[model samples]
Target: MAERVYPKLIGARLRGQTSYRASFALQCVSSGLGQLVELGVILILFGRVTSLGGFSVTEVVLMYAIAGVGFGLADMVAGQLDELPAHIRTGTFDVVLMRPLGTLAQVMASDVHLRKIGRIVASLVALVWALAHNDIAWSPATALLVVLAPLSGAVIFSSIWVVANAVCFWLVEGQELANAVTYGSGSFTSYPATVYGPWLRRFFAFVVPGSFVAYYPGLALLGRPDPLGGPALLGWVSPLVAVATAAVAGLVWRFAVRHYRGTGS
Candidate 1:
């Protein structure tokens, strides 16, 4: 049954990941330190001014924390998409297709990095710091949205990675450029969307849905006014964006798999 299969695959991955303790530990530390360094930039920017592009230090940090944990969770699971090109290039994708498991689930569960816990922890610390200073009303709905935001964020990011990697089926050499969507957007969502021009913001909002991944959901959570002056209600659309993105990605991935005629390697 799928219930038993998913856990067995993921558990096996966790065990294999833990087999190399030193490497795992180093990655964890580095992941934490890297996030701190990004936070340091925000702190330094705030030291010079009250806010950046209308987002206060706490707000910006909150945005970063929400985005970081969301992206980190996505990366820990679906980062294997990055290796899809390699799988196809090496003719291993054929083997993957032959397996009893679903290709998407198998690829998603393939690279479960425990080091991403470092990024999650760093985000948690920042969230705590942000909550310490904010005047948020802890209403029941607010509580529910706060809980929903990060989980939806994970799905949003995972879908981005999935759709981007599906290109590997068409481009045999692989598209190294897909990082601009996944990794690049992770960096982009940490700041308020207002800092960018209408074109850039629209591209992210309409095309990639990066706005829903963190910025918009964050706007609603903090009860802060949108810098671009959109309806505050846009924040609630984050879950819809996540679901829609995943649906499209699933369709693309399935179509790509159907079309993949392995290179005569």
Candidate 2:
């Protein structure tokens, strides 16, 4: 039942957005351009230096592409969770709760912004360009990692969105905090983990685990050894990290939902 219903829900939202064709197109262009600007910054920086933290311009672009696509997809799908506080404040959450669908499912499917695909498209182009420019040893494993890396990164990012936004159930004003963590993770993961200081790298790696989103998989894709001396096998552990993060997010979300007592308005 959910299999059919979720698609219908998403389809309805997609149709509504497409109804404003010109606006939709403009929004997509704007979104893609904005994302490209970030990539441009990396290129400009590399113009002055040959390498950053032992990574070339192309290698850093690979990281950016993976992280950008992951975050873009997550933002399109689960970013609506940021509005949970507004729904709670306006008492519309009661209506959401009365629906037959799972709260998270309905909330996620409520607003599917197709404009965010622009960011994904921009990053995908970069991914192809990076793959072409890099010295990759093509193999069955390498091919599989290339395909799975972005997807696993998406799951990792989406789980971060869920866990961070779940705080809204307790602190309706927690959106800023959640945005800091979620968007911050995206920004942090857009470069090689080696670029950052050890403390920042460790924080993201252990506390938030954003490193799994791009940096590790990127190492595997590029056939580069970890500059930090971590095992090469860590590159392939993104799927495991994504699954673990998602499980933890599920628990936090459920706990938050159960603790909700409404605003009593």
Candidate 3:
């Protein structure tokens, strides 16, 4: 039942967004431009320095591209989970719970921002440019990593979104906290992990595991060694990291839902 219902729900939302073609187009353009400004910052920084955290401009851009694509897709799909707090505060979550559909699925399907595809498109362009500029050692494994990196990265990011936002079950005001983790991770993952201090690197790399989203995979694609002394195989483990993160997120979400006692309004 969910298999059939989920697609229809998403399709309905997609159609609704497209119904106002001009507004949708403008939104997409604005989103794309906004993302480009961030990319421009990276480029501008490289103009002065030869490298950041030991990575060349092209290499850093690859990290940005991978993270951007993953985050753009995750944001489009699961970013609406941020509204969980608002729903709880206003008691709309009770209606959500009463629905036949699963609470998480319904929340995810509630808002599909197709405008965020602009970011994905811009990231793909950057990916192409980065690929053209880099000296990658092409192989079947490398080719496969290129394809799976963004997908696995998306899963990793979406799981973080779910896990972080689940705090709303206990702290209704936790939206800001969740945003800090979700958006902060996106920004952090867009650069070399080596750029961060030792303690901070370990936190984002192991605690949040943002390194798997782009940094390690970018290393694999570029055929570069981990400067921080991680094993070469870590780059290929993004899918594994994604699966593990998603499992943990599922457990957290279930626990949070079970703990919910409603707003009592």
**Top candidate (lDDT):** 3
lDDT score, candidate 3, position 188:
96
- Which ten contiguous residues of candidate 3 have the minimum total lDDT? 96-105
TM-score of 3: 0.98
Per-model TM against the reference: 0.95, 0.97, 0.98
Residue-pair clashes per candidate, as listed? Answer: 0, 0, 0
Query: What digit string (tens of lDDT, one per residue) describes model 3 on residues 105-224?
Result: 899999998999999999999998998999999899988998899999999999999999999999999999999999999999999999999998999999998999999999999988
Q: What are the lDDT scores of the predictions, listed in order? A: 0.85, 0.92, 0.94
Residues 145-250, model 1: lDDT tens digits: 8777888889989999998889889987656777778887788888889878899899888898888877888888888788787899889888888899999999
**What lDDT would candidate 2 get against the real structure?**
0.92
- Model 3 regions lying over 4 Å from their true place: none
On lDDT, the stronger of 2 and 3 is 3
Worst 10 contiguous positions by lDDT, candidate 2? 256-265
> Higher-TM-score candidate among 2 and 3?
3
